[model samples]
Target: MHPVLFEVIGLPISPYGLLIALGMLTGIWVAKRRGRAIGIPEEAVYDTVFWGVLLGFVGARIAFVLVNFGAFLRDPLPLVFSREGFVFLGGFLAALPVIAVVLRRWRVRYLAMADLLAPSLALAHAFGRMGCFFAGCCYGGVCDRPWAVRFPRIIDWRRGPVDLAEAEFTPGGAIYHGVDRVGDVVGSPAFYDQVKHGQLDWSDTASLAVHPVQLYDVAIQLGLFALLSWMWWRRRTLHGQIFLLYLWLYAASRIVLELFRGDLERGLWFGGWVSTSQLISGGLIVVALGLTLQRRRLFAPASEPAAAPRDPGDA
Candidate 1:
């Protein structure tokens, strides 16, 4: 609810931006420490993170714009420049190639580097989701439960719950009018009461009462971070195993959590229930498994050792 942290003289400082910065800094710090422990050059880790951040930001914005192109078309400038709308998967995808190229140029083992980064990424995601919670952007639908958070101010925007008038269109192609007060029955009368009173009306909070999917994500990611850290600490006896396992774990969690994401309006293609995120998660799971299997084959020990080559005319 506290979107803005403080005002310096007259300028407002955003809590969301601050939290995101903190998360990034913490993630980088953790990665650098882990990198050194794993024998990676500290400088290379920093450079990789620098490029990763830049590429990740760009990729996240691009993905968000693509997904919500219709909304972006209405106001392109704000949509592009605004701090909101970043997708975690988009950032991860964007950073992958950038990190790979950097590692390749530096002659660093990409798989080992990825393993070091896996836990840090999850840690960062946990903080970033907290930022989202503060910003009220990636919000859950609604809830009447005890843990449910009611953000009245968030619904004041044209895209929020209070603006449900925009969601309803008449058969004659006219936009429906919003009631300035209670007693309106087109939608939920209880919702109308809450809107009019500037309070959360739990009676109509069904779809809105969806589980706090972001917190669920945070909890899952923290567990993943712990698991990856343990695997890395134990050295796993194989390169890339930790990274692949992280991917598998995260994808599985996402697939399950996406079920509670009532905010997504898109429907499944074949069945009654499915999500875009779930589709992506399934793909990631398959890719991770393939990579894990490939790593085992490539890094396996050789059956015999070859003799050193002898130079001509040399002893």
Candidate 2:
């Protein structure tokens, strides 16, 4: 995969980082526009997102490090500065409390703020998954389908994948461990697996065709974004319904998607029967259900309360 989108002034720019930045900026722009309609100050929205993003990055990085602790210990500097390895759930969990604090200090309704951010979160995640696809990270299990994608070899020698390309020299002063038979080769855990299982030979140019799970994740997130946006603008009745729905739906989808994931870097337990994301998603599903039930109790049908103030400036 084309990890480096391009070079600027002799420096490489990674597609993963660029796409994530683009997603964040787009999410912020959309949030600012929607925030105004619901009486949320633009400045408040900006402040909330800023702190959330800053903390989210740190949390994601920390989670990545913890998950790959042995590798981090062996090579700490590269791991710390690497553009890849961020976990979405970790960042999301870390950002929630800070977001809540900002909303409370700004005198904003928590549910309203949650609703406003829900679609934006899905939108951003869809873009981030697209970035993952470009970087060949979060890859999917092998598939015989016509749409399966065979990822390109890792050109960087530091990562330790077979270099099938007939390169005159190797990068980082690392010895070329590839056979002289010139051919294309796949990269990473896929390469390692193929070699171990005899699925790949030195003559191969790419990994075995596999399911494009990252694209599937992107599609799911976009669909969620569309549904949440529609609910936000048209069918929103209860204040917290959209946010709760987002949580429930995404958690459910993630459980299914994790089944197709090929990468083993994400933690697994119970003899690989349960993944970390799957376990987390299961808990989130229960939490969403409970919160939704509790939220519904606040709007009893027997004694309908007055309509909420259109402007929640002091809410």
Candidate 3:
């Protein structure tokens, strides 16, 4: 996987960051177009998209760092200032209340607005999954299938069993000078000819073959977007149902997809039996189910008033 897509002068353009930004822009554009079509004010769309994205990005970063607190504690600046490790669940959950507040303040129907935004969110997420593919985070468990991809830069030995001395002496493993098994090279060459040949790269990284979960995520999210869009088109008379359906479908999808995830930072409960996203998805599914049923009942045709009782004598 290519972490750094390229460099402009001295500045690096990360595919992860670039793609996330592009996805946000696309989502915003969709919201604006749909809001206008629904007769919503342009200002409302702008306010919601702008603030929601900003806050959501912050929330995503904060959630990721908090979940992986121990690692960040050692050297906090890299994670704090860098544009990686943004958790989608954190962003989605955080954006909901903010968007709700914005809509409520504007006196707009929150459910209708949510419906308009649902497909956009899915579309953006599809792109974000592509970003993850390039950046190599959110990787899946190792697999030997034909579709299983090998990320040459993402080695499997970062915190795994490592003998530094072996890395130094193993020809093309990694070179170290004045460090032992733990980077205490006694008298190894500072730079080997292979280093110039690009044999060794960013030291901590390792290469391993893993499932291409990113592609799987993209496929599912795009499919969800299409489904939501179609539902919105067909059920224009229905308010909130489309969004609820989206939540239910997306939550179900996330639960299944988390099973393939190999990243350790995503919280795992019950000794790794249930993932954090899976738990959230389960909760969302229950909530959406209840809301869907309730909303449908509220919108359903009322039962005909019971016929006026007639006195048996009169009959």
lDDT of 2 at 131: 90
lDDT of 1 by residue, 190-268 (tens): 2333443344433344223435667777888889889999988875667677888899999998888777664442224
lDDT comparison, 1 vs 3, better candidate: 3
Model 3 stretches with alpha carbons more than 4 Å out? 154-206, 297-315
Model 1 misplaced regions, further than 4 Å = 154-210, 265-272, 299-315
> Can you tell me which runs of candidate 2 are displaced by over 4 Å?
156-189, 192-203, 298-315
lDDT of 2 at 271: 95
In terms of lDDT, the poorest run of 10 residues in model 1 is 172-181
Query: Judged by lDDT relative to the true structure, which candidate is superior, 1 or 2?
Result: 2
Quote model 3's TM-score: 0.77
| TM-score for all models, in order of appearance | 0.76, 0.83, 0.77
Residue 133 in candidate 2 has what lDDT?
89
lDDT of 2 by residue, 1-315 (tens): 666666689766777789999998899899899877767778888888899999999988887777667556655665577667788888988998998888767766767777888999999999999998887778888899998998754455224345443233233212121111112222444544454356776356677888899999999999999999998888878777788899999999999999998766577789988888898899999999788778767523312221233455654
Query: How close to the true structure is residue 156 of candidate 1, measured as C-alpha lDDT?
Result: 27
How much lDDT does each candidate structure score?
0.64, 0.74, 0.68
